[model samples]
Target: MTLSRAESAADHDRTVVVGAGLAGLAAALKLAEAGKAVTLLESRRQLGGRASSFLDPSTQELVDNCQHVSMGCCTNLADFCDRVGISDQIEIHRILYFLDEQGHVSRMSAAPLPAPLHLAPSFLFLRFLRLGQKIQVARGMIALLARSADTPGESFLAWLRAKGQQDDTIERFWGLVLTSALNESIDRIDLHYARQVFVEGFLARGRAFRVEIPRTPLSEFYGPVLEASLRSRGVDLRTQTNVARVVFENARVAGVSLRTGETISAKNVILAVAPHHVASLIPEENRRQDDRFEGIERLESSPITSVHLWYDRPVMTYPHLVVVGRQVQWLFRRPAGNEGYVQAVISASRDLSARGAEEVLSIVRAETEELLPLARSATLKHHRVVTERRATFSVLPGVDRDRPSSDSSTAGLVLAGDYVQTGWPATMEGAVRGGYIAAGSVLGLSPAQSLVPSLQAEPTVRLLAWLAEYIFPTRKGTLG
Candidate 1:
């Protein structure tokens, strides 16, 4: 039976959203909030997509596919949680802990100062770097802040070298943040995005540097809580529903065809899935003719590895730790109510991904013990290693130009995903922004009207950022 024949004429006005990830959820929520009929479709039985969790067959406990984190600069993601009534489920941490291989922990918290300077106080105390090294790092940051425009097709590593940043400074400071945030090597990341990360996350405001982490399992957090909330808002939520292809009429989207030989017709369709999945949905002839589909093939993905370990006793005292100069980039004490269970994540783990699971576990366990001495006394009760080979799209140099906008050449078809040009990296915030922009396009609303504003910058901070650009305005074009 056709979904169109099963509904009233009001169904014709419904906007069908494919994929139930953050992007799709955001788009559906915005459309529903606008009093527009929304039907959300997900091929998976559960929601949240990559930011999801599943039952461990051996332990029968919930484990996330990855460790998802948010920062103070992620206003759109915070807004989405607020709108969905899960704001309280997120725990805000003012202090960030960084642990060295020798188990020396350095605490980083903002001081009661203005933007850019707020973090300066704590940065001075980091035990990982020497005083001379910190001064050099500070100079590199000033250069990063002062630059006005991006050098097209330039890697951040090249830009960093041009600023006279030493190799030690790049690895100890710049690589520490960009590798985890962008999920790509510093050498491959675009300079434009690396600058955005620092300016918005650290230099914009004092509060923008704070961290936000969920206190519950992703499956429960997104499954019941978000599902109920979206459904309550009159959204037709369907899981385990797959769309075979988008049916177009005269180069316009009329509806989507299901794998089950059924069709759901709609006037507005938002393709919120990954870039690779997108081309298969649109007809070959249309994709060949559309500029929106161009260059999508050039977009590549990065990998992330998460290692879950359950010790016989509590080994980690801190809630989380940023492991400096180690293959295990970030470690989190699992919030799944399992005592002694913790997860270690390695982003941009291409080298590690090629290793066997046992080898990966061994490396992670050794690193954890080295960083946290208490782990040496604890017994490994159980363990699991999960590697998402295609975790996020690589924000490579010149890749932003290939990122299409929300509007498509095919009428009534909108695009939404972290891969879109959301002016942010492949993060939850970017996904939410993409969804809002796509929904905004459908409603004919401006980006300002549809999306939440970024954290306000201090007056002096704005002036400094502006002055830097004004002084170095000729830093455009290709940088060798």
Candidate 2:
């Protein structure tokens, strides 16, 4: 599409955004809405980066890299979808199902009660955990609610043990939640992020725990809708465009150099690409001098594996299930129109990477049969394994210190990615928050000023949180 009159007027004042992931799309959308001349560059033909979908040759169906879900607390992501006019395509499910090895299913749904207690009734009746274990888990939740800050270099695993949680309680309750939410093991997850997930997602608001899943494939959800929105705002959206490096001239940002030996000149540039790509984009001398650049390189990524299975008939009765005490962490039924397809997700799947596809399938198939009785009789039509080696940055203890903010030392250069310090874990919400922060840096706004507000806590919930903090003030020391 041709540029609008307003875009033409501000063509000289260009802000170039690299990477077309959620971060880049959010940044570009904000700048375009602000009437800034924007150019969004995406290396791949698809728009949603890791969140995008692909066409499987074997099944000839659009498949998401992994099943991505958003909670009600993910306000920025919800806002982005609404802004892009794709909000109707996402369906919110309030009931969450958890299945154990013995095929017993436990449903967790919100009641009419207030925050922190709305889901307590269902949680207390979970069939997977014994009464004693449930009580122990409840104590852990209270401790998490009362905590003020995270201990540096401490993992959630250590925190749970210190809270008097045992193997059964930790694995069935804590692991089930943290593994799926953070996409990392409890031993490696930062306590701050773990607290954020529970406090915001579970304890803060009754609606916060409701999960939202896209009704369509991710590509259809983000690619076309986002591209149309950007283009309508007169953003120059370029796909299959590889950026060679950010051209820094005289200690300031110039623009980006394309791999085709072409350079796009701009005063402001946001390197919203992956962390590893940042070092090569800058000059060698700048990399040596900049501490943030060095820290970005030190950040490590965790893996997620999605196993797609198709059967002759429906194998799962529920839309999704949180599989406990197994390598398979979550199982999801494909959205409507695809009845027989089910996707199993294994977060922190480094061990599975070493296995062959058939072996992996065998193990997953066995687990599926055990969890869902219908799967045992259904015929396996097709199967595919998709493993994202660098799915998300590991939220390890003390790792947030290494996460770079939107502002770079170099003038006119900004950063945006899930790996950036967004206060949340590596999620769609965190990504959009980083993008907004980057745009704010370019538009002379504070991070808080640019981002959308989180879902508000009820008055009673807020008072309880305050009391917890006020009564038991946190001290600077590691827990046993």
Candidate 3:
């Protein structure tokens, strides 16, 4: 097609994607790549939404709301990074370091064993779990494997107790992993989605647990890069442009009205904001009638707390470490030097908000000193406490049924977000999946058309996957 004809074709497929979060960014990019004239709108001046950064006045550096990471299971997010030319800013960690309160360390990586057994070596050698506790944990895994993979009906806590999981095992092992992944306590997280994290991210693929840590501030990684790419590809991105309402005519989306009362006409629209923001944006006439839109209102939020600590000297040896037996869940070391900067993560940290920032920081500092000897003597240069009261949606039992699909009742309107029934938790992967699904919805394509293929198991791991199914017959459902 000629340049004019191509431009005309793009005009014919003009699409408006609201909220330049990961979902909106990915959807806009996918549509633009697919020959659509795409316009991305965000109410905020900066993009990346929850995964964004702010200029810290005290340190004069960009600060992320919290440290975010992608896993090998996040195929779509990886693809999005590669497409946006920012993949080099990400550093992948094939190993993880865990530290108990006593400062006992355990190095965890994929062992040479087959699929489900790849993590067996590290778990077996860990000093944290006694022999009896290990045995109990093994039994718990057996019980988890025996349970139904689909049709989640209860809390993961209930399932763990029924499996005879000890309180210590639950706290040190299952709770640590589950709380971090789901951003909610075991009592609130669904058994089905929790199982999906272990089975797909741990069992189905040996390397799926690898972490992708960003080397730069999230602000640099997302906003500037996306702006450049969108402009080059003729995609319009409007910052600080609040979409007031989804204008509909005859049960079809006519356009979107801005806060300034100007209406931008478009052939298609994708609602790509957080779940809480959905109800207000949709016309009252349509939301009350469609259960799918109303279901988003039923979803709730979970809080996360991150502590950024700057020390005058090196405190931690590893890039990151999981803290055992503490409210502080994980620690991430900023690159270049291990000494100067580090972050502490606490998922489902509503309780932390009740305590003042100084108290929280004091406790975190004490805990840090106990774990890393260097921290005791190191001069504390600076510290910042970041608490996102509603960092993500609480994945309560049966929330799977509550999420709406990308295609909506209004003919040209679609939905996209980490909360939009992506089968994955509210992570980078899920957001990217939602974006791809939304892009597909507007372009008359299936998810498979825009989404990267799911990562496959190694040859030996594939055999172990079959063995896993045979031993535990309940492994018969889709992995998100």
TM-score per candidate, chains pooled: 0.96, 0.96, 0.92
Off by over 4 Å in 2: 1-11, 147-153, 469-473
Per-residue CA lDDT of candidate 2, range 113-179, in tens? 9888898999988999999998888777666776464565568888888777998888888888998
Q: What pairs collide in candidate 1?
A: none
Question: Candidate 3 regions off by >4 Å?
Answer: 1-12, 142-147, 458-480
**lDDT per residue as tens, model 1, 121-157:** 8899999988988988887666667655455467889
| Model 1 quality (TM-score) | 0.96
Predicted model with the maximum lDDT = 1
User: Alpha carbon lDDT of residue 173, candidate 3?
Assistant: 83
Sort all candidates by lDDT, best to worst: 1, 2, 3
**Between candidates 1 and 2, which one is better according to lDDT?**
1
C-alpha RMSD of candidate 1: 1.9
lDDT of 1: 0.87
Error of 1 at 206 (Å): 0.8
